[model samples]
Target chain A: MTYCVAMRVDEGLVFLSDTRTNAGVDHVSAARKMAVFEQPGDRVLVLLAAGNLALTQAVMQLLSEPAPEDKPTLYNVATMAEAARLVGDAVREVHRRDAATLAEFSVDFNCSFILGGQIRGANTRLFMIYSAGNFVESSQVSPYFQIGESKYGKPIIDRVVTPSTPLDEVAKCALVSMDSTLRSNLSVGLPLDLLVYEKDALQVTRFSTIDNDNHYFQMIHRTWGERLRQIFGEIPNPTWADPANVPLRARETVSNVPRVTGSELRAEPDTSAPPFQTLMQPESGQSQH
Target chain B: MTYCVAMRVDEGLVFLSDTRTNAGVDHVSAARKMAVFEQPGDRVLVLLAAGNLALTQAVMQLLSEPAPEDKPTLYNVATMAEAARLVGDAVREVHRRDAATLAEFSVDFNCSFILGGQIRGANTRLFMIYSAGNFVESSQVSPYFQIGESKYGKPIIDRVVTPSTPLDEVAKCALVSMDSTLRSNLSVGLPLDLLVYEKDALQVTRFSTIDNDNHYFQMIHRTWGERLRQIFGEIPNPTWADPANVPLRARETVSNVPRVTGSELRAEPDTSAPPFQTLMQPESGQSQH
Candidate 1:
């Protein structure tokens, strides 16, 4: 499993990925998931891959083959959208060749990619390419796309990132999101690839391979959790001690009584019968009343 | 879809569940995911369910049947473990009756449950029951269980909760976890059912059906996100402008260069090539060198 996230913000695009892969829990290894195609002044394309390593690596090999004059390649694609379509074609090409054989062994031809960068004529762009060889581009309304183990890291990005977020802040948010994923899931391990592209620069300016020692990531891991606990403490616990006076208590009639079957409990909670128990005796009959 | 979580702390047990159910994204409604069987002084059993609503509702219907003198039922179970076995039996019973029928329509016989409460003679115990009617009990090492749309809400609980956490604080953590889930997943919504049981009181004490209007839950929904974003701002962005002076930069030789295919890019990075472009012209050739 892996976690790859990329966002297209006003300033530029941000891409981050983790490098852990596993055959099962026992056979885990580190594999870089980022591919950079920099024509410096002309274009800077960052491709992040996830899913079956063999399939993705195969696609990478095919994409690396010298461009034929008859068709388009990542190097000569006219637009970000064209680069995406070429990636989709490559995925379909791989599926046609290897999927059926892998299917005999019960392996699905699964892979996905995030292609984002600037081409000479266009602004920064991002697209998520799918296993089915279809792709979707990022828009102002939805500024990001995440593939692979995405849920744990999603809320932070959902709350903080937007098309207008500054490039540096968006990069910070990606690392923070990755921090959550790393903490919740061991399968998505570290030594991360981070690339921040500046709009129209058409070159990679900020890139880092973050591992156990990357201080920014280290600070995020340590401080985010600590500060989270601090705020949790600061938020007053729902005052359940005295429901009658506690504003946070559900003051309405206790209509949400959990479905009580045909036990002695009831069709309705006798709210007035016994609101709570302070102490109990073995012979307490009203306790069950 | 639903989100239900249960934790056994030293003070007692905490259970929180969301009530949203959807057949697909188009058809959505609310239904209780929690059931309580309390013979008060004798025992207090709470069941939280997730998965195909039809299947879980069937399990609930089966569990609600009148207890016969010939066999054990939730109403008469002597121990918390026995109660869990009874719930498992109920799940298997439902599967035997409906799984094949559901499969005819390509519907999965999917359902899981978290059961936590106290039977008079025992201390509080928690169990997570799987679709196969198999189950595992919570231990001091793991102290909690969550079923359904659980990932978005997991990291906070992983960081904060423990067996020694106070009952109120544990309940607060459960709400916070649910808050994260609600924000991230539309499938898991409110109003929520929360129940907190005391270690020896052996009866329901703190229970709330928190909805959009519930102030405490509203606070958690509002404040948790706001504070999270606030703290996100406080965390310094990774300094990437000048890697030469930044301690956090990956100073050691970066053996982790992403697999570059056969483009003009070479096997070795020309480290001496001009790094990071501040300004560039269309004729900049070294930018790609």
Candidate 2:
């Protein structure tokens, strides 16, 4: 129902989220899902959420409330890990209060969050928190986290992103990923929230609320598809005439293509027959063979 | 898990399927999923399946057994529609025999099929049959069907394949789609079965059991990813300096990027807050204003 992705590259952190939410096909509406917490020179934190609107809003509400003097809150958390724990605690708190009532109506308590930023003393870090109030941080081998409708746009990110990727390039990749998702899935729509944080900046510098009219996103939507088609054409089609010369030749030892029982079919029928009779009837005398 | 896709184009039909099947990550094995029924100069039918391995194999077994004197079989079906109906009927029969028992074990009666080919008097047809034994035929607007782990590879097919696409190109698109799927999902693996049928041939003409050593598929596996990264690089990165010159500019009318309440934070807190308190607290004097 949503697409939110965040990357932790060597240069910085990038966060992006879509605005669309729906109860069903007919009840579609837009809601911004990116939230920023800043303390200027001290720390900067960004939270992106996906899942049930009510549950996410509830978690966000708990996170936004003033903390009791002795407790930790997003504003006073000393480290990125602590910030994530605070988010997880809020999620669990919501689950504690709302899960039972929501379960009565058959609504599963579901929500996920991407929390990424720098606290003055630490390095930029990114974490994905689950519906169950647990989380995992990004690592060198896995430099990103995506929540919601993630598969359609995943291949490209899996191919292009690494910890070494530049901040601007990572930002571009995130938008491109979002574009692919928006095209393939109707549930994720525009008016996006994109935030690019430079490592150690300790403040939000580059942020945008992109709508249908955004020129840069418009170019990506058009150019990515067109260029993809262009490259697809540029690749040579498989040549069946000479299997020996082609890369996708049929192998020698493997069995031939499977063909069902019928006149003029070459491949043998599967020896492991079913326990019951099939709809296929052999020609009069052929069964004897 | 498996990835099976079939396309219906003006030139002919293309069907591609992966061989990997798994009871769980620890019990991975390979089993061919494409089965063909051909009557040479009369008709040709191909079935590609995905879902519970036992259920699909059971349905396939029922289709392969000897038909009784009175019923229609793959050999006797007059049209492609009849062929799809026969397959659907086999699926329903399997459900009747096994669904309840499987339910006791909590295993779903989940399986789906892509059936396509041509008969002497009719045009090429493709249908996607669901677990319930109901099916829907492919149309010009949506000319392909994919079952099991399909989302990862869908965007490319959505952009490139259409009814007017040529046979070889369709085959290439299918492979590229499969390649994307293989990259993102560990459950779908190689040693793929590919079958290409030309209109009016009424028999299997081009088929390949492509393994990891298959050169053409190797070329596809390498070149596609390389060229994709190349093209991704060719697209200029978004320039943040001037929104007017770029394609991803932020719109002026929409609200500014969201910022949670905190000292030195510029953007306003969401005015329509949830009915509960948020973890965000405006600093001492800041909240009173």
Candidate 3:
């Protein structure tokens, strides 16, 4: 398991990936999942990968070699779309070479990548490449892509980020997202590789390798939880006292009892009975009463 | 699909379940996923279920009826463990009656439950019963059990609740957790059932079927996000300027260039190269520079 996320905001792009890889719990190890193709003054491409380590490594190797004949390589792709296509094609190449052998072992050839960066003359872009080598680009409505163990970290991003978010803010959001993922999931571990690409910079300018000790990340890990708990504490406990709480009204209407004490009677409503009394049991099973 | 969570806390127990059930995205409808078996001052068992609606409903039917011969029904179960085992046995009974037919249609015999309450003499307990007729009890260290679409809502519970948490606060935490699940997953939806059990009171005293118009819940849905985004915005953005961020130092140590421009040479440990620079590609592919 892995967790990688990339955001394309108005000012730039932000990428973060966890380094832990494991064939199983016993085989856990650290492997850098971020690859920076920094071609200063021309283009900057950031690739964050997750899934089978061997498969990702093989795809990366294939990406580095020359593409057949005039096909574009990552280093020379003129547009971000073409660059995304180049990645999908490389994934397809690895699938063609390895999928059958992997199937023999019952491993589903699972691998995914988040590719995001800028090509000079084009706006920053983000794309998520799938195991099947098909891909989807990020849009203004959803200007981000997450691959692997995504849900635990997603709500924060959904609430905090948008296309116009500042580049540095996006980076912070990514780290907070990663913090949630790391705490909830054992498969995604540190040190993390983080890269913040300024829009149109055409270079890898802001990058960090955040380990457990990185001061800012440590601060994030501590403060985010403390603040969350503080916020959680401040939210009022849900009140059953409110009239809009139907079950309370139903209980009132159904005399003083909280139990429906009969099976499926709500479907055949008694005008005298409340609108909802759903917890059901057979009348014979009322001995405890 | 559904989301049901039960927590055992120092004050008592908390149960919350979303009513939405779906055959697929197109076939969504609402069904109650929570069942309350209150024997007044004797026992108050709450069952929260998720997975195949048919399987869960069938299991519920089996649980509602008398067990064959002298076997105890949930109404007669002497302990919370016995109640959990009864639930599991009921699940296996459903599987026996339906699994083969379901398999013919390629549907898994999937269903699970969180059973929690107090049985007069015992302390408040929570157990998760799985599809295979086995169950595990929650402990003081991990006081909650969530079934179906659990991950999206787990991190918050992990951070906020404990066995020592107050019952009302646990209820609030459960709702907040459900809010996260409902926002991140479409399968978990509105009109939630929330039941708060007091330690030795045993009868269902606080229960609410919370819907869209429920004032407290509407406040939660609005305030949780606003406060989260406020808290998120308050956190400082990550800085690559921090020297503790190794990638920044690596660039300084490896001359002014940001690209490594060659294959996996970091292993050779050029003392000149700052300890970690694993992103690699062939030297021949440096044309973009």
Candidate 4:
């Protein structure tokens, strides 16, 4: 499993990836999942991959190979979308060559990638390519893509990031998102690769290989959780009784039933009815009435 | 899909569940997922279900029916573990009745539940039941259980809640977790059911059916994200190319990099190739080096 996220903000693109892989819990190991293609002053394409290690490596290998006469390669693609298509094509190619053999051992042909960056003549663009060789680009309405072990870290990104977000803020949000993922999932661990590319720069402006000792990330990993807990503590607890208490949600109100009494036992009955005792006793024998 | 979570803290138990259900994006609707059974003094059990709606409802119906002989029913169960087994048994019963028929329609026999509360003689307990009619009780190390659409909300809980956490803090954390889930997943929506029980109180003292208008939740939903973004704004941006950068990983002191030239582009290619980019560059030249 892996967690790779890329955001396309007005100022630039932010990409982050973790470095952990496991065939099973006992076979866990570290594997970098980021790849970069640069022609300096021309095009800067960064890819972040997730899923089966073998298949992802194969796709990367194929993309690294010189383009064959009939095949589209990432290096030769004309546009960001073309690069995305080439990535998807590579995934499909891997599927064609390995899916059946892997399936014999019950492994699905699984892998996905986030392809993003600028190509000299065009604007910075982002895409998410799936295991089935399908892809979709980011838009103003949805200016980001996340692959592999994404959900744990998604809510923060959904709330804070947008095409209008500042470059620095987007980078911060990405780190916070990765912090959350690291806390909840063992499959995503440290030594993060973070790349922030300014719009039309066509070269990496900010790139850091953040290990456990990375000061900013360490502060983030520590301070964020503490501050979150502090804020959580500040929020008022639910007012249990008092229907008229009026909470933040104005649409509905709590029912004014007597709070359950620990000592007030439910009805006891003879052999025919059976003696009863429980936390929620019926208010009365109204049903029988 | 639904998001339901339960925690067994030393202070007591906290259970929260969302109401949204959808067969597909266009088929969205709301339905309550939490059910309560209280015999006032002897026991209190709350069942929060997620997964195939019909199957979950069927299991609930079976649990509500007259107790069958030779089976451990929630009504007659002794310990929380036994109670969990009863729920599992009911699940297995439902699977036996509907799984094969559902399979013909290509529907999965998916249904899961988080059952938690007090049974007078036992301590507050929480258990998560799976589709296979197997279950695991929460322990001190991992004091909570979540079912269906869970990952989005998990990181916060992993960061904040523990058996030693106070009841009020747990309640607040649960809402925050639910807020994150709601933000990320449309399948989990409002009209949440929240029940918080105090330890040794065999009764349901605090229960609220919170809708979109609920004030406390609205405050949490609003403040958490806003505060998060604010905190994000305060974290310094990654300073590019600084050897003595405070944000750099403490263990790896890098000295060769030049300071970032603000708004100025350097025309020279990097003289020293960093190993990070070398591994990421898919080109054969970099690979051979």
- Best candidate per lDDT, number? 2
In model 2, which regions exceed 4 Å deviation? Answer: A242-250, A262-289, B241-250, B263-289
lDDT string for model 4 (A158-224, tens) is 8888888888778888989999988888888877888878898777656777776566677778888
Q: Candidate 2 on A81-196: residue-level lDDT in tens? A: 99999999999999999999999999999999999999998999999999999999999999999999999989999999988888878888999999999999999999888888
Model 2 lDDT per residue over B25-113, tens place = 99999999999887667777899999999999999998887766577887777777888898999999999999999999999999999
Q: In model 1, which runs have C-alpha deviations exceeding 4 angstroms?
A: A241-251, A259-261, A264-273, A276-289, B241-251, B255-289
Clashing pairs in 1: none
Sorted on DockQ, best first, the list reads 1, 2, 3, 4
TM-score of chain B of each: 0.88, 0.87, 0.84, 0.83
> Would candidate 4 be rated incorrect, acceptable, medium or high by CAPRI criteria?
acceptable
> Against the hidden true structure, what lDDT does model 3 obtain?
0.78
Please provide, for model 1 over A1-289, each residue's C-alpha lDDT reduced to its tens digit, 9 standing for 90 to 100: 9999999999999999999999999999988899988776778899999999999999888787765566677877788898999889999999999999999999988899999999998888899999999999999888999989999999999999988899889999999999999988889998888888889887777777777765667778999999999999888765544333323222345434574744432433334333532211112222321
Candidate 1, residue B14: Cα displacement in angstroms equals 1.0
Native contacts retained per candidate? Answer: 0.43, 0.44, 0.29, 0.23
Compared with the true structure, model 4 gives a TM-score of 0.85
| Local distance difference test scores for all models | 0.81, 0.83, 0.78, 0.76
Model 2 / residue B33 / CA error / Å: 0.8
Clashing pairs counted in every model = 0, 20, 0, 22
lDDT of 4 by residue, B68-180 (tens): 35555565577878878888999999999999999999999999999888888778888899999998888999999999898988988988887789887888888899988
Interface CA RMSD, all predictions: 8.5, 11.7, 9.7, 10.5
Top model by DockQ, which number?
Answer: 1
The local lDDT score (0 to 100) that residue A110 gets in candidate 2 is: 90
